[model samples]
Structures are given as structure tokens and as C-alpha cells.
Target: MSEPIRVCVTGAAGQIAYSLLYMIANGDVFGREQKVILTLLDIEPMMGVLEGVVMELSDCAFTLLTQVIPTADPAVAFKDVSVAFLVGAMPRRQGMERKDLLSANVKIFKVQGEALNTYAKKDVKVLVVGNPANTNALICSHYAPTIPKENFTAMTRLDQNRARAQIAQRVGTDISNVQNIIIWGNHSATQFPDVANGTANGKAITDLVDTSYLQSEFIETVQKRGAAVIAARKMSSAMSAAKAAADHVRDWWLGTTGTFVSMGVLSDGSYNIPKDIVFSFPVEIQNKQWKIVQGLNIDEFARGKLDITTKELLEEKEEAMAICNAN
Candidate 1:
């Protein structure tokens, strides 16, 4: 058995962490053979709630959970951590614009980023799960100047999973049948869930479904699925978001098998997206490192979609940068 590792999850008292903790404790992420020390961090006011969550974790009798560190201090939570799930940030409230959320989250991430830089492992893999995630991640990386830009990523896997499910439901096949469904650009409604290169059961998705459906309904549904969930449930997606975060870490750690997966990695000028802003792209993982898949043909329509989403990210990046520069 390998040495035990520390995993940190911020916003430990929140609904998503409530669902996510069990997944990590059960060894769904790092293999069942590996032991994990969970560092659950929330604000000072929420430590009482975190204590209850820790009690529940203790009762689960998971062999892989060797220790649980519950603290309000970023220093304690981030110290020597191997994998950090940055789930703690101010959520968008009623009638809040993206810029408002960006302003709030940038400050939170700046502190966490500094913590990661000062205390975390040099190679710590960070995933930003909060809203305005891509910009938050960019700002986080900006603060942690020593950490590699590739180490920070935002969660667009949720959107990717939704796209796959919609494709499967429409094509009358299992979700696993759809591979390489790319979520281009941001995590918001402007995100373009491109299926141009995706294959369903070794056949082209465009061939399996009508071009019109893929172009119109498929794009709109995947883009607005989160809002639909919020509308129906009166709460944002928690369990599904947790599951996607796990999938992302699992794939990133263990390496991808057959097809490329969607991830919001820092843009490297791929597909004409400007560098610095984290943008979702079709990526393949190998040796615990993710690289954007290259050389896929982008038709005019896909180019237009990418440009639209890139515009949103650029604006978001501007807002986040302004906050960082001020503070």
C-alpha cells in the first residue's frame, strides 16, 4: 500500500461536500488501496456544522478514511495537502450578476491560492468547483505563482456529463456510448457543448442524431440544464456536481482510457482562445497530467460558438483581475 495522502475540501459544511465526502471516503477517487486524510474546511461560523459532518464521517466505518481534519484555518487545511478541492466560495444569489459573484469569489480564491502556495505540495492538483469557476481558477493560479498553470482547473465535467446524457437519451443508447463530447469555453450558458468529433458506439454522433437537433436543442439543453435543475429543485445541483468532481479527479489521477474528456484547463492558445483564462476543451489525461487534444477541425459554426463563449470568459477574466489588482 502507498503512503496515506491528504485531501482538502473547502466549503465542507455545504450540500455538495455533504455528498462528496462519502465518495472520497469510500475510495472512489484515489483507489480503494490508498488511504486518505480528509481536511474539511469551512468558515469559523460553520465549524459547528463541520463537526457534525465529521461525526458522520467517523460513523461511516470507512477503512480508507484514516483521519479527518476539520478547521477554519486555511493554513491547517492546505498544509502538505496533495489534492485540494476548492469548493468554498460565495454562490450567486437572487438577481446577482456574474461580475458580482466574480468580485466575491476572487477574494476567497486569492486567500486560498496564497495558502496553497505557502503550504500545499509543490505538485498539488487544484480543482475549482465554485461558480465563475474558470475565472476563479485563473485568479487562484495568479496568486500561486509557483504552482504550474496546468495544475489548476475548473469543473466543466458537469456540463460534459449533462451533454453526454442528453445525447444518449436522444440516440437511445447508454451514456457511455457517447465519447469525446467537448464542452468548449466557460461553464455558463454561453458554453458550447460541441459534438462534432464525438462518436456514439464507434459511429459519428452527427450521423446518429439529426444535425438540426445537435445544433439547436442539444446545445440549448446542455447550456441551460443547471438553470432547469435550479428551477425544478429550488436548489442548485449538488449530488450530480459532486459526482462530476469525482469523475474529473479520478480521470485526472488514473489517466483516461479511450476518449478525451472535457476539462476547464488554463487556455494555452488552443482553438484560438487567448491564454490565461481557463477554458474547457477536449483533453486526454496521461501519467496524471492533462493535455488538450489537438488537430480537430473546427468548422465555421463551432468557431462562432467558441468565439461567443470566449467573449464571456474574457469579460469574466477582466472582472476577476480587477478585483485581484485592487486587493
Candidate 2:
């Protein structure tokens, strides 16, 4: 067998981690043929919880899992890591200001960026799943000058998947038939789920669904799905979010030759999005890096919603920059 791939996941004590670890161990992300060495990283206070998670992994006896290492040290956890999933963050409390949240996460990602630069594999691909994920990914990518900017991405596949499921339900078709749904701009409430270019079993989505319904109801549902989940479950989305994270990385590392997914990445001026903002776009993975799918015509409606979501991303970037400058 080839040498095992090293994968590091931060925030191993959290709910998403709880859902993600078993999946990773069972080869749900990397495939059964690829042996994996797993590193679980968390704060000192959560070390015990991480150990418990490790114990559970041990019980599974996963043949593809070579070893499991739990650590509180970034350098140790990220050492030689091929894939880094940054999931830990200071979540926004009921009244927490954007500045406060940004400042706190900046410190966390800065240290992680430095550690990644120093210890991860030369080709390490990072996916930030924390809240304000796009901005937090920008912080890490900006700080890690050694890592190619294209190697850093934030999770928007969740939004894309959610859009696909919603469209499938409305069309009374299996989700397998839904294709080309694009989630534009950001991962938050302002995210634009564009079905203008999407299709259900090769039929244009716009032809099947009312354009107004797609623009208003469908878009809003995809954008606010996270909040809706939280409201209903009384907890942040964990299982589905974990699955999305896995799918994002799996498609990235494994390649998306004929498929497209959404990822929040440093913009290259696609769709007139301001450069350097980590915004979601339709992308395909090749050679373990995301290349934004360009030249898609954006209609007036799609363009308007894209602008709205991109503006939200830009504002978040500004908030992060302000906090960094203030400190």
C-alpha cells in the first residue's frame, strides 16, 4: 500500500467534528483504498473529549485508518498534513458584535496559518468551515504566503447541496437528476442560489419552476436554511454540515473533472466580484486546486442577487481588516 495520507481536523470536540470523525475513519471522504493518518486538534480544555472520540475511532477498526493522533498543538497536529479542515471558531453569541467575533477568530486563524506554513505538506489544501468562513479563510490564505491561494477554500458546497435538494423536491425528481445549481458570492444569509443555469434531468430549471418563485422563495430558502435548521433543532447544523465538508474535500482532492461545486475562494474578478474577497463561485477541481468556472452568462436577476451576496462578503472582509488594523 502507498504511504497513508495525513489529514488534520481542528475543533475535534465540536458537534461537526463528532459527525465528521467517524465518516473519515470509515473512508467516507478519502475512499476505502486510500489509507489515512488522522490528526484531531482542539483546545486544551477539550483534549479529553477528543480522546474519547479517538477511542471510538479505535473501536471501529477501520482498515484504511492507519493511526489517530489527538493534539492541542497546531504544529504537532498539522505536521505533514495533506488536508487541513479548519472548523473551530468563536461562534457569534446572541449580542456579539462583528468586530469582536472577527478579532477573536483572526487570532485563531493567524496562528493556524503560521502553523500551516511551517508544518503542513507543500501541497496542503485547506477548507475553512467556521462561521464567517470566507473571511476566516482569507485571513489564513493571506497570512500563509507560501501556500498557493487556490489551495485555500471555504465551504459553500453545503449551500449548493441544499439548493439541489430543494430543487429536486419541487420538481418531484430525484436529487441525482439535479445539476448545475450555482451558489454565488458567500456562504451566509446573502448567498445566491442561482438556478438560471441549472437543469433537472437536462431540462432547464427555469422552464420548470416559476422564475419569480425561484428568485424569491427558492433563493431565500437556500440562504436561510442554516438558520432554519438551528431554529428547529435548537443547535447549529452539525451532521449535514459535516457531510458537506466531507463532500467538498472529497471532490477537491479527488477531482471534479465533469462536475461543478460551490466553494468560497479568493475571487479572480469572476462575475465582477471584487478581487481578493473569498466568495463562492461555480468551480471544478483539477490537480487538487479549484479553478472557477468562467464565462457563464449571468442574467439581470442572477447578477442582482450575485451583487448583493458579494457585497455582504466584501463587508465581512472589511470588518476583518478593521479588526486586524485596530489590534
Lowest lDDT block of 10, candidate 2: 318-327
Model 1: residues with Cα > 4 Å off, grouped in runs? none
Best by TM-score: 1
Q: Score every model by TM-score.
A: 0.98, 0.97
* Cα-based lDDT at residue 46, candidate 1: 97
Clashes of each: 0, 0
lDDT of model 1, residue 245: 94
Q: What would you estimate as the lDDT of candidate 1?
A: 0.93
Q: Model 1 reaches what TM-score against the true structure?
A: 0.98
What lDDT score belongs to each candidate, Candidate 1 first? Answer: 0.93, 0.89
RMSD of candidate 2 to true structure, Å: 1.1
